[model samples]
Target: MARSVDTRGARPAACGLQGLPGAWRAPFLECAMTLAAPEPATPMSAGLFADEAGCPRCSWCQATPLYRHYHDHEWGFPVVDDRRLFEKLCLEGFQAGLSWLTILNRREGFRAAFARFDAEAIAAFDAQDVERLVQDAAIVRHRGKIESTIHNARRVLALRREFGSLAHYV
Candidate 1:
């Protein structure tokens, strides 16, 4: 006995796989089916709100351009680079009592002060570097957070040696 799949009125656009070659259909469908669908938005749901462009977004990211850009481009995306992973960990530590937006705004400054989050470079940071960073107003001047970042950098090196990369360890 043979069962046939009904293909009546099926449009590729509806499946979001339009313009893909026929060979991709099966794999794409398989992957798509395995992922959970997002919940439908409701008027009472405070989780989502429309931006000025009418695109629905998380409510917290609507306050500024930097937040919106970060939400759209970086948030929720997986990062595999060791430096970026280290940067994220350091920033989250710095964000303990502050808004993420404040960190995002000064991200470039942090990068500059912390040697662009390079684990090897930051791992070498010493007392003089700490003093230099404390006087720098570009990033958070909290000595504890700065020290933690330097300490974490050394850990990152250890993780790299054991796990091959931070992404793999994570």
Candidate 2:
């Protein structure tokens, strides 16, 4: 289903300062503050192109290119496959308390650490893997998040087996 972009109620005309009473005008302008005008809606099929400024906002990417790429290319679009969904979820977990840039700078390390984010491979990660990851300088070395990633990978795999795809679960 195609979603409508609602422009209604999003803009207010500027008050003509010359004609308004000073008291009424300052209050009006202050209250009338609004979001910057939205760009024309893009086609839905453009994949993640809808929010390409990458500022759709995920708590972590405050002001960085990595955050931009992730938001523009990965966040919030529908996912219909299991492995890909699991990968994103795993990354989101890693981003739980840290800035998105921290994880993003280590994204390549993350991929390598989690074996390209393959569900089966990640699910197989054990204490040894966790230990190796702790020693790795590429990714954030948080033990709890690391453990949770593996646990979540297994859960996603189970969901895929039962539902045929994680996207369907969503």
Candidate 3:
């Protein structure tokens, strides 16, 4: 039988995983390896798990800097902006079947391609726009996802008008 490590016994420091007990190490490594499995979207951004600044963060983000910034700046924070809320909604949809980190890496690409996720602009997208998006290398190339973005954009228009903002509607 495999033995379990006592997390309480060690002081987690630096890369948080390094401080885990021996038994915990293998399981943690296994989990990390699973997360590293190849997917349609691979994260290009990486970050530190621990630094001198004393910011407590989830050790998982330490695997990549991109995740670190997201964890520190965006994760668990309340978002109030209407457009930003809409953007998050769309991004979450794009995340379906794709690694969240991969979506994180390509967020900029998505923003640029989709007019920074302006629902009004995206609502105007037509078949040609989808064709253009499917061929774009910076963002996910799935045809259904591209079309879904446009469809959702149109739906969001009514929600925005009714709720006064995407933040409120959501």
Best by lDDT: 1
Q: Could you tell me every candidate's TM-score relative to the true structure?
A: 0.74, 0.61, 0.69
In candidate 1 the C-alpha lDDT for residue 39 amounts to 45
Put the candidates in TM-score order, highest first: 1, 3, 2
Prediction 1 global C-alpha lDDT: 0.72
Encode model 1's per-residue lDDT on 1-170: one tens digit a residue. 11122222222243342322343232323222122223442242446654443344568877897987776556765566677788999999999999998899889999999999999999999999999999999999999999999999999999999999998999
Model 2: per-residue Cα lDDT over 1-170, one tens digit each: 32223322311233211212332222322333232334553433323222333212333434576665565344544454565667778888889878767777888899988999898898898999999998889988999889999898888889889988787888
> Relative to the true structure, how large is the alpha-carbon lDDT of every model?
0.72, 0.63, 0.68
> Can you write out model 3's per-residue Cα lDDT over 43-100, one digit (the tens) per residue?
3333322244433355687778898767644665456676677788888988999899
Best model per TM-score = 1
Select the stronger candidate by lDDT from 2 and 3: 3
- Root-mean-square deviation of each candidate, in angstroms? 9.9, 16.0, 13.3
What range of 10 consecutive residues in model 2 has the weakest lDDT sum? Answer: 10-19
